[model samples]
Target: MKLVCTCIGCAIEASCPYSAPRFYLGEGQAWARHFTEDLTRENIVKGLKETNYGRCVYKSDNNVVDHQVVNMEFTGGATATFSMCGFTRHQERRIQIMGTKGEIRGEEGKIKVMDFVTHENTEIQIPEQTSGHGGGDSGIVRSFLKEVCGYNGSEGLTSASASVRSHLMAFAAEQSRLNNGQSIELDDFYKKLLVQV
Candidate 1:
C-alpha cells in the first residue's frame, strides 16, 4: 500500500488520512523522482543530525536485522505518534495571488479565484479522485501534463515552479528547526541551490 502526506508529522498510523506513507518510502526510480533534487550527501547528513536518531535504540548495533526490528518498534510505537515525534515539522502553506482582475488562493490541491470587481468566486474541482494528500497527485499530474503537451504555458492549477517553491519551503522549515528555529529566508535558500547547480 502507498500513502502520501505533506510531512511525516501529519501521519497517523491507526487512521491515516493519506493512503501513502508519511514520507517517500518506495524503492527504485519512483522514490528517486520525488527527492532527486535534494538527495545530496550533505542534506542526508543534515537530516540525520537534526532528527537525532543516532542516539535512539534503533542505532545500537548498526546490524541490518537488529536495526530493522528496532527501527520498526521505534516508528510504530506510541512514541512515534504525530504529536510525540518532533523530528519533522508540520506546515500547510496557502499561496494567494492578487491580480487586478481577480485573486487566486491555492492549497492542498484546491484553488479558488475570486473577482473583487464582479464579486464572483470560482472554485476549481481538481480532476481525478485521489486519496493522497487531498488530491495533490491529481492536480500535480494534470498541471504537468498540460505543460508537457504545450497546451498552456503558465496557466494551470499549479505550475512546476510553484511545486518547487513548496518543496523548498519544507526544506527550509527543516533547516530552521535544525538551527534552533532560526528564520530561514526562502529566496536566499533557492538562490543558494541555483548557485550550486
Candidate 2:
C-alpha cells in the first residue's frame, strides 16, 4: 500500500482564509463559530482579535518551515509520503491511497475511486460545509465527549498510545529532515527519548 498527502497554502493576498485577513478581520470571516458561543459581530471580532488568525505568514517571527516532505514506512511495510507547502495559488489538501485491489484520490472535497479488478471508476463530491474540515471538527468533538462520558468503544476514536506514536513519527520525520534526510529508525528514536527522560 502507498499513500500520499499534501497541504498547500495560498499567497497572502489570495482569497484563502489561511493567509488572508478577511477570514478573521474582514466581512468574509467563515470561522467565527470557533470563537464564542455568541454569534454577535462584536464578540466574534473580539475573539478573533485575541488570536493570531489574521497574521501575515511571510512576516511571522515563528520558526515554521514553509515547505516539507516526509517519507514513512509502516510496520506492515506500507509506504507513505506527506508534504506541506505554503507557496501555492490555493490553500487545499490532497490525498491519494493505493492498495493491491483499488486506489482512491481526493482533493478539495472531491473523491475518486478506481477498482483494479473490474476497472470501475467512481467519483464522489462532498458537500461544502461551514462547520470546518467538512464537519469533521464537530464529529471529533462529539466523539471526545462520548469518551469522556464513559464510552469504552474504540470506534471513531484514536487510542492514546497510537496518537503518541503518530506524534513521535512526526518528530522523527522532522529530525530526519534536519539531518539532511538521513533515515532514522523509529524504535531507536523512541528508546533514545526514553533514555534522555
Candidate 3:
C-alpha cells in the first residue's frame, strides 16, 4: 500500500504546477487565503494549473481513513475547490469608472453615471430588465446605441483610460494577495496604461 501511494505521489509531483512537490502538505489556511486574493478568472486558471485537486470527493469505502476525514470536514469548502476545478458557474463582471469629471457604475441592465463637476446624475434604464449581471448588458447596449447614433446629447462615461484603470484594480488586488496582502503600488500600473496622458 505504501509503495502504491508513493508511486501516486511521485506522478503528481512530476505533473504538479508549483515549483515544489507535495503541494497539499503545507499550511492549508495560508494557501486558502492566498487563493482568495486577486481571485480573477485568469489568476484562478494559473493557480489551477499549479494545483490540481478535486472539487468534490466521496467516500466509497468505510476503511479509507483519508476519505472519512475529508467527508467530515468538507461541506461549504467545495465552492473554492470547484472553482479551481474549471467549474465556474458564472463570470464576475463589474465596471466602475471614477474620474475628476464624474463616475459610472455599470452592471446587469443599469448604468448610473454621475458628474461631480456638473452635479448631475443620470440613470440609464434597460428595457429588458433581466436579473442576470445586475442589468448591465441592457444598459451597456442602450448607452452604446445612443452614443453611436448621437442621441445621448452628452459624452459617455467609459473610455480607454477608464477601462484600463478599472481592470488595473483587479490586477493590483491579485498582486497584493500573492505578496501576503501587501498593498500594491498603483502608480506603476497607471503609468503602464498612460492614464494621465
Candidate 4:
C-alpha cells in the first residue's frame, strides 16, 4: 500500500507528494512518540511549544538509523532480507512469501494466497485488531500471564533463545552500520556481548 500510495502521488503530481513528511516532528510530540500517545490538542500544542526538529535531516544528534537494510544468510544457504525506510507515502507494511507450491502476498490487514498447481487465488481478510501491532502488548501480556499461571510450553514474550538471537542480530546490524557495513559473525558477536555482560 505504501508503495502504491507513493506511486500514485508521483503519477498525479509528478513528484512523490506524501514522501517522508518533510516537516519536523517537534520534541514532546516527536514522530516516534506519536504512535504511543493520544493526539489531544493540548498535547500537540505542548510538543510544539519548545522543540528543535528544524535541523537539517543530514545533520542531527539522533543516533538511530532512519533507513537500513539487514541481510542474513544461514549456514545451509537459506537467506532473508529486511529493509526499512522512513521515507514512505503511508504507514503500511507489505510482504510477499514464495514457496515451491504456492505463494502468499500480504500487508497489515489483508492477504492473498496463490496456488501454483491449481492456479487458484485465495483472499484472506484479517479480523478487526483490538491491540496495537495486531494485538501486540495484549498478546504478550496474556502469554506471560499464562506462563506465570503454569501453562507449559508457552511462547511468553518470545522464547529466551529467540530473544538472544534477535538481540544479537540487532546489535550486529548497528555495529555493522557504524563500521562502514562490515559483516559481523553472529556467534562471535554473541561471545563478545557475553564477555561484556
Candidate 5:
C-alpha cells in the first residue's frame, strides 16, 4: 500500500446553514418528531428548546472547541493529518491520500484518483445519500442486522482490530491536542492505556 501521507478534514460551517429552526421548521420536522416524547408540534418545539438545538450555534453556552488538528505517524513511518473546523461555508468532510503508486482525493461523495505510473486521472461519483451521515448510519445498521442474523455482509464495518486501532488513533490525537500537539507513539500509548485500565 505504501501510503505516504493522508489529510482529512471535517468541517462545520459557521453560516448557521444547519440551524435548528432551519431543520425543525423544514424538512427535518419528521426527524424532530422522532426525538420528541410525543408527536405533538408543541412537545417537539419544547423538547428542542430544552436542549442546545434551539440556540444559535455561535451563541451556544457549550465551550467545547470548534476546531482540532491532529498529526500522526504510523509505525511504518506513513503520516496522516486530520483537522476539524466550524468556519467553512458548508459542512463536509474531505480526504486526500498520497501513496507510492498514486493519490486519491474525495469530497461530497465524489472521488478523484490519479495514478502516477499510468499518468491517468479517474473520477467516481458515489450514489446520492438519502440517509444521515452520507448514508453511513443506515449502512452500518443494515450491516449489523445482517451480521446478527448469521450472515456476514461484505460491506459491513472493518474488522475489530482495525476499528480498535482507528479509535486508538483518535484517542491519541485528542491526547496530543491536549498536550500542545505533542507527537504520540501509538505503541507506547496503547501500552500505557492498557496498564491504566
Candidate 6:
C-alpha cells in the first residue's frame, strides 16, 4: 500500500499550500516533458529534468519534504506508521506482517511464514536465476490476461470505487503532512468523499 519514488519526493517539492512553483518552466532548463524521455545520461541531460536537479537534493525544493514520518490509527484501533526519505541504497520493497497466529516477512523474492502454535518455520526459495531477485515480470501481463484477468476481466483495476480507499488514505496523509503531522479521523475524511461522489 506504499509507493516510494522520486515522484513522491518531487511531489513534496512541487506541492506546498503556498510555495509551489508555477506551471511555467524556469529559464535555461529543458522542457518538462523530456524528463521521462529516457534515463540515459545523454537524454537526462537533454531533458534538463527537474528544476533543482543541479542543486543539492536537500537544498533544492522549497517546501517539499525529503524525509517525513506519518502515523495512522484505524477505526478498530489498529495502527500503522511509515517513514520515507530520498536516501536509500535499495530500490525494492521489504515488508513484514504480524498477526495473532503467525507472521510473514520478506522482500520481493522470498518470504518466510511462521506459525506460533505449530512452531514450524518454512523457507520459500524463489529462483529467478537473474537480477538476484525471486520474481521478475517476463510474461506477467500475458499470464494475467490469460489467467486472472481472463476471468475477472479488469473489472476494477482503476475504477473509482475500487480505488477510493487508497485515494482517500493518500489525501489524508498529505493533509496530515501539511498540518504538522496532526492525526486525521477517517470517518470525517470519508464523509467528505461521500458528498463528492
Q: Give the top-scoring candidate (TM-score).
A: 5
lDDT of each residue in 110-185, candidate 3, tens digit only: 7899999889899997565444445556666676777787755555644456667668766665565566657555
Residue 2 of model 6 has an lDDT of 32
| 2 or 6, greater by lDDT | 2
Report the poorest 10 consecutive residues by lDDT, candidate 3: 64-73
lDDT (Cα atoms) of all candidates against the true structure:
0.50, 0.72, 0.48, 0.64, 0.72, 0.57
- Candidate 2 lDDT, tens digit per residue, 1-197? 62211112334356544543455445445556566667676776566545554344555565867899898888999999999998775567889999999999988888999999999999999888666666668777787787888876665455577778889998998899889999989999999999999
lDDT of 5 by residue, 1-197 (tens): 62221111113322356566556756667667555857566776676666545655544456776898887776678988889997675568899999999999999789999999999999999899878777878887786777778665453474567679889998888888788878888899999999999
TM-score of model 6 vs. true structure: 0.58
Tens-digit per-residue lDDT, 1-197, candidate 4: 31112121233322433322232232323463543265554554343332332222333455778789988887887777888997774556678877889999987688999999999999999876666666556777787777888868746575687677788788899999999999988889888988999
Instruction: For candidate 6, write residues 55-122 as lDDT tens digits.
Output: 33344445766677777777677767666775553445566777889988876678799999998888
Off by over 4 Å in 4: 1-38, 50-59, 154-157
Clashes of 5: 0
Ranking by TM-score: 5, 4, 2, 6, 1, 3
In angstroms, what RMSD does candidate 6 have relative to the true structure? Answer: 10.3
For every candidate in turn, the CA RMSD to the true structure comes to: 16.1, 8.9, 17.6, 8.8, 10.6, 10.3
Minimum summed lDDT over a 10-residue window in model 2 is located at 2-11
Candidate 2 TM-score, C-alpha based: 0.69
TM-score of each: 0.36, 0.69, 0.33, 0.70, 0.70, 0.58
* 84: Cα error in model 6, Å: 2.0
Candidate 4: residue 192 Cα off by (Å): 1.4
